[model samples]
Every structure is written in structure tokens, then in C-alpha cells.
Target: MVPNVVQKGEVIAIDGEWWNSDPIKVEAEAKLSGGAPNVSDAFTINGQPGGSYNCSKSGTTNFSVEQGKNYLLRIVNAAVNNHLFFKVASHNLTVVAVDASYTKPYTTDILVLSSGQTADVLLTANQAEAKYYMTASVYTTQGFYDKTNTTAILNYVGSNSSATPIGLNIPEFNDTATLVKPCEAWLRRSIQWTYGHSSSLLLQHIRCLYHRLSFTSPVEFNYTGDVPNTLWAPICGTKVKVIEYNATVQVVFQGTNIFQSDNHPMHIHGYDFYIVGEGFGNYNESDHNPFNLVYPPLRNTVGVPVNGWVAIRFKADSPEFSCSIQKFYKFVKFDDVATTLDVSKGVLAERVPVGRDIGG
Candidate 1:
């Protein structure tokens, strides 16, 4: 486990063992210089520095955190597939917000985090004596991966003399915390019934609104002709023409036969977005869609249906537009091997502004 001192805009490194087994390397790199690092590679703790692992690759290092008395823990599942449960031992972690919006703070022993979902917590480690473990492990809500990874350890001040604290036992996924589903209304109501109150009024409100909305007919189109035609033109236009910093951007991710999953956890960098709405087969135009007009979750990542489409709306508002938003754009272009093969056609080109923001 990795122990971190709460500070605003401070980057923290996480690496440890999972399920009492071998150690797995967990590293997060900052997206915007001093912010929390995005996970790039997954490595075995016992393997050599540049060895192979699942979810994350290699060369991914240093997750960042802000330096302040109270801050948010922006957790993202870099793993292509896997849900996680994050918890800190011997402390009542108060979740202040989620997906970058302020919410009523509620104390909890553990927080359930899904792939591509970010949770912000207000943690104060004021204990004078005693060591606590802050853990992020795989949840068995769906299927099983090889083993859960040890994300970090939170050591109380004065627990150890040295700057690096000793590791703690990796918690088992079989624990009750891992099995519970906090998203279900019944389960949440049960918690409120037992605790006699609710901590997340925002979540409660969102859940009510989400269920109340009636889904319209799914939008459909010919995948082979329409998608390639639509995507290729924009991609070509965006690649060659200089894009203004203030341009409004919309990215629609439509899953194909190659990627046959029902849903994909789509993540964005630099800015949070309104989900708008999503459907099973295709997006609809006509029925009463509440999410179309109402405010959805403001998040950095969202899940796109496997055979359907998920539309995301966001403004290009980052100072260093190139650094903050380039990664996501790069991933989309290189998603298929055929696109990478036509370099001579200038399908993939690099553009650099000479005197741009050097910090990015």
C-alpha cells in the first residue's frame, strides 16, 4: 500500500500487491502537469521494470494530487475491462463530490468505483498514532481478472521515521465491501435505512431523475457505409485544417463488429462533459428525452454501448490545448491498424506550434 499526504495538485505514485498474491505495479501520470496522473501501463510488481502486464502497459508513472488540506481523489480505471472498489482503513472517508461536481459529503468505509468513473473524496488523516491502508482493488461485480492490484497505502504521520512507509496486507476481493452494489436503489435505501440518513443528496436526485425518464426509440444507421463516411471526413478535416481553440467539439463513439462488446468505458482528458443521453441500438431523435435537455453527469469519461453510440458534448477550454487534449485524439486515430498503414497518404500527421505553452 502507498500512503500519501493530502495536498492540492500534488502527484502521488501507487504500486502494491493484490489479493495477498504477487505485487502489481499501479502508476498514474498527471493529465495537466500538476493534476492527478492518468494510468498508462499495468505491470507486475515482481517483473522487471519494463515487463508486461494487463490493463496498463509500460512507461506510465506518477499519479498527481493537489496540495491542500482537503482534496479530491480522481480515480479512473485504465484497465480495458475491470471495476474497482477503493477504501481506506480505520478512517471515515467523506465523499465530497463525483465526476468534478460538488455533492453532499457522506462518510463511508469504502467507495465503489466503476471503470471510467471518477470519485472525489475529502480525506483528513488527523490520527496522531496508527497506520492505515488506502486500497484500490478489482471488484467481482462482473467477471474476474487475474488478481487485484495494490493502488496505494496511506500512512499516518510519525508512523515511520523514513519518508517511505512499509507496505500493508492487500485486502481480499471476497470482502463484503467488494461484493456490495452501491448503485442499486434498494441497496442505497437499505444503507439510508440502517444509517438513518443519506450522505449523497445529489446522487439520490440523479438516480430519481434517471429512472423517471422514458427512453425513446433507438437511432439506427448502416454501419458499413455511414460510419466510415462520417468519421473519415471529419478526421481528415481536423487533421489537415488548423482547429481553432474555441471550436465546439463533439465525438460520437460507435462500436463495430471488430469490438463486439455491448458497452465501452469511453474516457476523455482535459475537461468534463455532459453525457446527454445514450440508447441500446442507436440514438433516437423524437421521444421525450429528459437527458437531451436536462443536465447529465459532468464527467471526464463515459461508457459507450458496444453495438450502439454514445454522444459526448464538450467545449475546448484547456489552456494548453495541444497537451491537455492530444492524447485522446491520438488514441482515436490509431484505434485501427489499417489507418496506421497509410502514412504516405498523410492520414496520420503531427503538428506542433513553435512557441506554444512549454509547461504542457
Candidate 2:
């Protein structure tokens, strides 16, 4: 949960407990403070320091809140395999931002958060209560692993007391049984264009060969099919090859029974995009047509509809470092059999044409 403070350097303590289990670990670090030391290295539960709890863990950490101002509370779900929804038990927390984007401030009783997702909240402590609880619980979304409620008590000194702050009751959430069906369908469609059966593979190989030839010779070519043309236009003609970043991206997600399912949260590194549109049951234009094509929420990641297609667009731009195009190149095979190209001609040509040129 986010906290509202007066200024920098105000000491604040956070405390909480995991419901029905061993206390969950709590670790808070200052992101701005070089290396951002783990300010909250300790753990606690239900006002008690340590005890034998079956399914939850508790902890507390102290930090200096700035004076006369607004600050961002960046929370990460380091929990191994649980989806958590967070809220301030007695306060109206304004979600001004999400995953680092400045969204319209929306007040809610609880914030539904997923594993590996981060949320920042804005809280104003204009009272003299001195202490209140920030609550986090598991969402019932599709494929959710852990099921427990956790609470973090935030204490503010010299603050007025209020019987109830604002939003307290945590709403019910279902991630798996409600959100996975659409996401799965979208994922299936996305991979088909890139890594489908025979025809798709042949097309990909042809495109890769074309790119390699363009790099060595002063030529340009374009080929299109299930693969979108706009996505490959820029690299249609290029020479110099550079390698930089490489990562293994995998999505091994599950759903409930697979029919009437829930959407899955899909994320990609390096860029953000809009959902644009989605559809279910084979993406038929006539059958499934309702979609917001105008102005959807621009997000780094999105939840694809159950049993449908999720389309996203991202600019292939990376200023920090170039990503290796080799992964795509490696997947291209000439046919059912793999053939090796003889590079002796090119290598010998490079050696003979440095300072002088031979002409008839």
C-alpha cells in the first residue's frame, strides 16, 4: 500500500502478518538511495515478533518518510508463488500509478495485484491515529498458487485517530478460474505466426535467408504472410551485424478446465503496448467483433481474454544495448534437412580486398 507523508526524513514503521501460515518475509529497500539498502530486513505477524504459524509469516521495517510532500511506495511481490492483492485497511488509497505509469487516481477498497507485478499507491496520513494496517490478500484468479491473507501495520506518530479511514473491506478476486481462458487462447495464436507447423516454418526460413543476403550484398527484399510485414520492414536492408542482449522467454501457464476460463497476464520486456483488441473461439471477424480499437490503456503488460487472441504492438527500439537477432536466425531451417553454407568465398574475398582492388 502507498503512504502519504509530509516530507522526507520522517521515520515510519511497517508491520504485518500472513494469514493461516508461517509469517511471510518482508523486505523493503529505498530504490533512490544508491543500492537502495533493505530498510525492512526484519519480519513479524499480528503485532507478535515471531511464533509458530502454519501458513503465514510476519515482519516489520522502518524508513524515514520525507516531509512536506508526496512519495512513491514501490512494492514487489518476492513471494515464491502467490498472487497478492493489497489495500490500506482504513484509508482511501489513491492509485495514481501502476507498474510505473501515471494512471488516473482511482480509489478502491483493495488493489488486485499478481505475482511479479509491482504497484505504487498514494496515502495521505492527515490524522493522528499514529497507526493503521495495510492489508494484502491472495486473489482467486486462475492459476493462483497460494491462498492466504497478509497484513502490514503502518504506524505514523502524531497523527489524529479515525475509527475507519476510508476503504477497508477487501473485495473477492478470482485470477485463475476467471482470467486464464482468454489469455491461453491469445498465446496460442501469437506463437502460431512465429513457430507454427510446416508452412509457417518455411516462410520464416525464407525471411531469415533474405535478411542474411541483404547484410552481405547491396540488395533489399520483402516477403509477407502470417507474419506481419510492418514488423519486419526496418531490417529489410542492413549490413553491419551487432549482438547484444539475449534472454529465454517462456510462458508455461495453466487454466481451469480450459473452456469457460479466465484471462492470463502477459508481459514482455523492453517495451510496452496497447491490447488493441482480443477475441475468443478462433478469432472469427463475424463471430467475435466487440473490441475497443480507439483508446485502450497503454500498458507494459496486459491480461488476454480467456479463449481468445491478444494482440500487442511494441517498437523494436533499445537504446541501452542491442538485442541479439541470432535467436530468430537460428530457428530458420532451409527444409526438413539442415544445410551448411560454405563461407570460404566470402572470407577469401574479405582478405583480398582491404587496401587494393583486383580488376580485369
Candidate 3:
């Protein structure tokens, strides 16, 4: 039985898995940087570097959930890097909200979220078992950055239980469209809002915030295995996306890959916007126009396709600060500035970075 809460229940997931079994077991690289042996040059969870090099240094945790109780897990990917897959063993997570937007109740064994996305899941401990394992692992569409499988114990009070953690089907580290892409297409916006469909009249007044905050993947270091090259750095800037208050805004993210081709999970700070359009190759003017303004799935964070692009739309009606974070596979990460920037009272925007161009 799903609870009734308008604009309060949506679901999103995260995956950025890596762990150092041995802190000093860095692999010698063909590239000039981060080669030989260095634990500091690795992917991380929370903030600590992770590696498959050391098994004794794992960061598994323990937690308890009372039986017959309904717990809402507000999961957030505040990490500046990597998308992650999360789930509780033997429990069907009922997703209720995503990025502060309410969504229809949907159950699944595993949930995938990119960096900066949030999912509010209702955990109902209805099973007879008294213990389970909650897991969060790396989700890679391009290549593996880390394979850290962070686990936590879910123990129920006042009952019998096993010492071993229960098993779950958290999607494989590399299953993108196989396990992830369908989930991305499955999310639909709530029906409680006014005008469930977008009208062309409303579409004509679209305030397109079209600008390419472009970054390219390098081609110098190509380490192909399960692990991606831990050498080449993807460069980006601290961009402030300024928009209007109480007005509809749409933004497109175009991705480029030269060295290593990968996908990016773009997250927002304040509100869940409609994921109107997305595809491969560059986002064109004629082809990508006239978006699916008719009740597209709304999410705070969306995936900019691997070596492609994604377009999203939302209204800057909420009076608060928000952020748009861009977490590329091994390179770029953006700040959580806000969902919409209110530059009213004749104030337009923060000083434009010199040599920067505003296309919209």
C-alpha cells in the first residue's frame, strides 16, 4: 500500500564502487601520471580512496530496522564522483520521491542513482527474517572506475537472525542499459500537478538556457580492463547556471569524449525537472526541438548519455538556493549551486567568466 503524499515521493539511486584492498598496491600505468604505486591516486567513497588491492581495509557498516515498521530511507549521492547502485537484500524498496518531486509507487530489487541524485524509498520490514544486508556498489556505463561494494547490516529487533548477511541482486558493475537504461525510462512524473501535458502555447514561451559547458575526454591514456585509466584528468569549471524566477527553463547538456568515452549523471539541487529529450551525437537545433513537453518523467538528476546529450526542463518557482552537479565518469564534477537562479531587480547574473559565451 503506497502512501498518499503529493510532490513528496520519488525515487533515484547511486553507484560509485571502489575500494583499496591494500592502500599501497597501485598498478604501474602506461601513462606518465598516477603510475607505479600511489594510493592517493584512486577513486573513493565518502572521501577516502578505495582499492581492490586491500581486503582488510573495507568500510562495511551495521544497522538495525525494527520489524513491522516502515522506514523511509532518504538516500543521497553527495559524492563529487561516480554513479552508484543501492539496495537492501530480501527487501523490495518502494520508491516514493526523487529530487523532492513526488512519484508513483514503484517497487524494484535494486535502485541506481548518479552523483548528487536523491531517492526517498519506503523500507517495509515485512519479511520473517530478522537480518538483511543493504548494499551500495559502483554503476559503470562506460568503464569501471572502482568496484567498491559497501555493505551495511539491516537487523530487526527482538527476533532470531543469522550471522551472515542476506543476498540481493544489485546490478552488475557494468550493466548500464541492461539494468539501468530501462529504469531511467520507467520513471514518470506524478499526476497531481496542474496540466499533466505540455501545451505548445506554453512551449512557445520556453526560456531556453542552451549553453555548452563543454569538456572533453582525453585520448592519451587507454587502460582497458575492468578498470578505467586512473591517469587522465577531465577538466571542468565552477559554472553558475543563471535562470529566471517563477519561469520555465530548459537546459541541454552535450558530452564529448576524446580519450575515454563515458556517461555522466547530472544532478540538481532544489527541484525535480522534466527529462524532456535526450539522444546520441550533439544536441541539434532542429532535431532536438519541440520536446516531449507532455508529462515527461521528472527527476532532479538525469544522465547525459555516453558521448551524447540530454535536455531537461523545470520551473524556477521555488524560492531557495539550488545546484546542478555534473559528475563525469573519471573527470568532471560540478557544484550544487541551485535549481534556478533568481536574478531579478535588474540583477542579471554573476560576473561572466572572461571568454565565456551565453548562447541562450
Candidate 4:
């Protein structure tokens, strides 16, 4: 169990969902097709499609709140294959925690969460005494998605429950900037940890490691730009990168346009790495743009922006075998390989199972 770093008022749990019609039948077909999975019938909140959905009004999830009180909204995106943009009408959310790690309170009007990511946000019931719609919609650059959004109700104490809740405006289905803007604030670690290294050490050591990994790329074209038809077929195999214990490891994940330009959320088990830097387009190692080594946000999963890249750093201290893989795949096939961290004294150690064996 995780403990809150700051005051967590009344806690309210919320989660994103994907309503399916005959999930078993379609899942079987999706695996065989080697293509994008079938789009979900509806986006839901806590299993209910909400009032906006046809025949779901009576089952809408509603929460009663008193004015001047604070409620902590713990939201998790559990959709099978989609990122989400969530918001409450007329209320700004103060993001205090993410992926079970507390972050310095950063207020934003919108929240973007990729699958398997969790955010703890504080919502002050300071708005007018009325019913407000809490909604979640798709945040993707992909062509296919569940167009219908999910909704719930934030009913202030004594507000008319029968009243039609005021709805909130969500971003356009494919709005990439809105999705990235919320993350620009760069959530900082609320508490300091001693694992961070000096910038000079990072450049000298991590740069050499990155140089070795960069060459592993089959052929570098315009990574974030158009890809030739010949490059659509991905190279698949098992590869392991051995690192020394307590060594700082930095990885740059580049999102390519091989099949379709889209965001990829990468996750590494058994490690909460610092998200040092990220930007659109291919990452340049010598750009000299500084990484936030001082108080970077630590997360186990990070979303690589559509046609972009992200750099993460972590201390490879855990002796256990760990794997890193993309959390969601739409355009890509089931060709992802598990990159393991076998931290031993220049020798491969015995592998132990701790996370998902996604690479088969």
C-alpha cells in the first residue's frame, strides 16, 4: 500500500473503462488479424457508460459533495488500448500524485492518462452549488477509437439531482497539443531522493550507454517523419542490456511513423525511473538541453508522444531481472521484445519472474 505525501482529503476513486460487445469473440479475431484491435463500443467510468450513453442514465455514478470541502480523485486509466483525457466542468484539478508516487501539486484544467497510469488529483468543491459532469474522452492520434465519451456526476450537497448536469468540453478526438500541454508543467517530485546524480556524471556515463543502444537501431531514417513501406515490418528478437548494479541508466524511446503515427506508453517493471526530458521529433543526444536531474518526476511508465521521443533515467540497483515493453499497441504488431536488466558483476544472473512476460 502507498501512503500519501500530503493531505489527502476525502478520497474518491475513479477509473476509465472500455465497454465491449462480445469481447471474447473480437479478441480472438484481433489476435489472428495482426492489425488494430476492434474499437470499443463505449468509453465508461466505473463500468457505467453514464447518462450521456443511451439507456445508461439510471446507472450513472454520482458523488455528493459539500461546498468548501476537498476531495481527492484517484483516477486510473484501465481501458484495454487507449489513453484518456479527463476533466470536470468548471473545476481545475491539482495533480498531487501519479503512478503511486506523490508529485508537487501542479494545477491543470485537463488530465491525460495513458493505460496503466494512475493519478491522484485534489478537487475543491468551490464551484457553484450545482451538478457538474465529470467526463473522460479519448486522447489519441490513431484513426480508430471509441468516439463516445463516458461521464459521471459531481453533485454538490443539496443540488437538484434531477437537474441535467452541466457538461464539459473535451479536446478534439485527435488533439495532440492539448494532450502534451498538460504534461508541460513537468510534475516534480514532492520529496527529494538521493539517487539523482550530477549533470556532468549523467552526460559522461549515460551518454556512452545511449551511444551503444542507438547503434542497435536497424537504420535511422526520419524517425518521426514518414517511413518507407519497406520499414513497416518490425524486426523481432530477444535482446538484453547488462548493466552494473547502482549504475545510472538512461533510455531514449523514439516513437516512429512506420505504420501509423501514435503515442506509445513504455513501462519498465521493478523500477520507478525519473522522466528527465521529452519533446516532439527525434531526440538529439548532443542538443545540450538540460535534463531535470534535480527533481524530475519518477514513474514506472511514460508516454512517448506521437512522432516524438522521451528520455528516462533510473538507478539499476535491483538485482532481479526486469523487462520493459510498450503498454499499449494499436498500429504496431505483437513484435515487442523484452529488454532486461541483468545487474551482476559483468555476468548474466539467474532470471526471476516479477513482471509480465509480454515477449513470447
lDDT of 3 at 105: 64
Q: In candidate 1, which residue ranges exceed 4 Å CA deviation? A: 1-83, 89-119, 124-133, 139-145, 151-259, 267-271, 278-282, 286-288, 292-295, 305-309, 316-360
Q: Give a tens-digit lDDT track for model 2, residues 46-90.
A: 343322233333333322232224444555544322345566555
How well is each residue in 49-83 modelled by candidate 3, as lDDT tens digits?
32223542354444466666777777776544566
Candidate 3: stretches off by over 4 Å: 1-60, 142-144, 158-162, 178-247, 267-272, 278-298, 316-360
Q: Which has the greatest TM-score?
A: 4
Residue by residue across 112-189, what tens digits does model 4's lDDT show?
898888998888888889999998898877667788888989889888867889888889988877887777787322
For residues 21-89, write the lDDT of model 1, one tens digit per residue. Answer: 321222112222443223333322222121123333333232222222444455544433444556655
State every prediction's TM-score relative to the real structure. 0.41, 0.45, 0.59, 0.86
Q: In candidate 3, residue 254 scores what lDDT?
A: 54
Best by lDDT: 4
Once fitted onto the true fold, the runs of candidate 2 whose alpha carbons sit more than 4 angstroms away are 1-71, 127-130, 141-144, 159-167, 173-263, 277-295, 305-311, 317-360
Candidate 4 versus the native: TM-score?
A: 0.86
What is the TM-score of candidate 2? 0.45
User: Which 10-residue window in model 2 sums to the lowest lDDT?
Assistant: 198-207
**Full candidate order by TM-score, most accurate first:** 4, 3, 2, 1
